[model samples]
Target chain A: MLLLVLELAGTAVFAASGALAAVRARLDVFGVVVLGMTTALGGGVIRDVLLDVSPPTTLRDWRYLLVPAITSLAVFWYHPQVARLRRAVLLADAAGLGLFTTAGTTTALALGAPVYTACLIGMTTGIGGGALRDVLLREIPMVLRKEIYALAALAGAAVVALGDRLQLPAGPVSVVGSALVITIRVLALWRRWHAPVARGLDG
Target chain B: MLLLVLELAGTAVFAASGALAAVRARLDVFGVVVLGMTTALGGGVIRDVLLDVSPPTTLRDWRYLLVPAITSLAVFWYHPQVARLRRAVLLADAAGLGLFTTAGTTTALALGAPVYTACLIGMTTGIGGGALRDVLLREIPMVLRKEIYALAALAGAAVVALGDRLQLPAGPVSVVGSALVITIRVLALWRRWHAPVARGLDG
Candidate 1:
């Protein structure tokens, strides 16, 4: 039940980001909706696909689809107000990133995936939506270009994998893992931290 | 047997395209290999995921992985020669598109998917790799911006779907469908056919 709620919330936040991007790009209403849905669902879908989950849980449940659709439409109608709340959105996005990464890692571990694969899936789950949205909008993915995003997710996933190997309880381990991700992301954002670019490329 | 051969050939062609794109983008060696693998396997992975095929055939088979890895390395070493064969590469890409689209539609149909779903999967299978490649290269997907690429794939997929509905033999149906896609793509390239853009967007 908690996981479901977190997933829905994450979907809404990601959808909002996608909708905002679409509006900025001057996409039509249909394009806005499509991009929103893709952004919200892309990560989970990628995770599920890697884990061999058919049809994906998001596709199986109408609520998952509805959350993004409604959220996108809401953003479309009231974007100015929504954009004004950018700080809140960023914070919520960090929370979403944490929740998705931990959840993806946990799910992969449950499914008997190797530790390394699970960690990769977890990072992918956290960053895949934003990557897809950027791709659709013809921009370099923020995670790829500059950000502590993917590394944070990977770190959190590693914590989960470590906990699993140590035979720790899942519930507390998940909480700690998620907190780690959220902290790292929020701090990175606050400090404006960036991943280094390829050296000597400009020369 | 034939399908396997087609799939391998398609993977190689897509890998070449991706490696060439990565070289043009000035990605490092690691990025070149990763992009090549992603392009070669992406479409098939998407199709398999949608159809509930666990582990995706590309991931399960060593040959599928090996082909792209080798192809990318070859392209990385001899990019100038590869670039010089642009015409040949384009033609091969068209053939790959045809084979993948028809094969994807057939696979979905075999899994008892609805006709519309099968057609979409088929089109995705044909175009998903190139879209991923473009996304990674920070360019708008060629299919979305201009060209008859996706439509040609969709039309071919529809042919296969129609053949299935009519209870035609899979062999001849696939051949005809693939031929339709190849013909349309080749003609589109020769005649410079393009999909219409959104009207009044420039203004």
Candidate 2:
């Protein structure tokens, strides 16, 4: 139940980011909805496809589709307010990163993916939507350049995988693991942490 | 057997395009290979996923993975020659578009997806990889703006779907449909046939 709530919350936040991106790009209303839905659901769909699950849970479930669509609509109509919530959006995005990474790791492990595959899937799930969003808007994916984002997700996924291997209770493990990711991401933002760049190149 | 051969041919051409794009971007060796592989296999994987086939055929089969990897290696080494083959690349890409669109539509029909869904899937298979490649390079997808590119693929897919509805043989239908798409695409390029632009806006 807690996992389910976390998943929905993550989707909503990701949808907001996607909608904002679409608005910035001056996309039509239809484009905004398309981008938002893709951002919220594309990662999970990619994971399910990799795992060989049919029909993608997001496509099959009405609630999953509805959440992102409604959220995008809200953004379309309330741009000024949504735009003003920059700090809140960042915090929400960090929370989403934590939730999605752990959830993806646990789901992939349950589906028999190897630990490494699970970790990759987790990171993909956390960052894939935003990547898709940026790509649709013709921009470089922020995850590839942003400070410590994908790395934070990977760490969270690793925690979940380790906890599962040790037969830890899933609930506590997920909470602690997600919290660790959130803490890392928030601190990275505050500290202006950045991944190393290739020297003597225009990054 | 024929389908498999056609699929691999199309994948090779797409991989070449992707590798060329990576070289133009001045990406490192690993990045070039990654882009090439994504362009070659990404479309089919996406179609399979949407059709609910798990593990994507490209991921499951070693040959599918190898074809792109090899093609990318060749491109990385012979980029100057490859770049000079722009005309040849255009011809090959048209062939790929036709083959993939028909193949994708047929596969989706065999999977019991609705005709409309199958048509969309076919177009996706034909264009999805290139769109992904462009997005990764931080550019607007050519399919959305290029001269009747996606429309040509859609027309071919529709032909295949119609033939299937009339109980035609899959082999002949595939050949005829793919040929039609290639002819249309090539003609569009030669004659400068383009979709109408929305006037009075920054297109």
How do the predictions measure up, each by TM-score? Answer: 0.62, 0.63
The sequence of per-residue lDDT tens digits that candidate 1 reaches over residues A1-203 is: 66678768889999999998898899988888999999999999888878878779888899999999999999899989988998878887787788889888899889877676677678778888988998878786656444567667878999999999999987778778888988998898899875433233354
Give DockQ per model, in order: 0.15, 0.16
Task: Flag regions of model 2 displaced more than 4 Å.
Answer: A1-45, A48-106, A112-123, A126-130, A136-138, A142-203, B195-203
Clashing pairs in 1: none
Give every candidate's TM-score on chain A: 0.93, 0.95
Interface RMSD of each: 5.2, 5.5
Could you give candidate 2's per-residue lDDT for residues A165-201 as a string of tens digits? 9999978888888899999988988888654332223
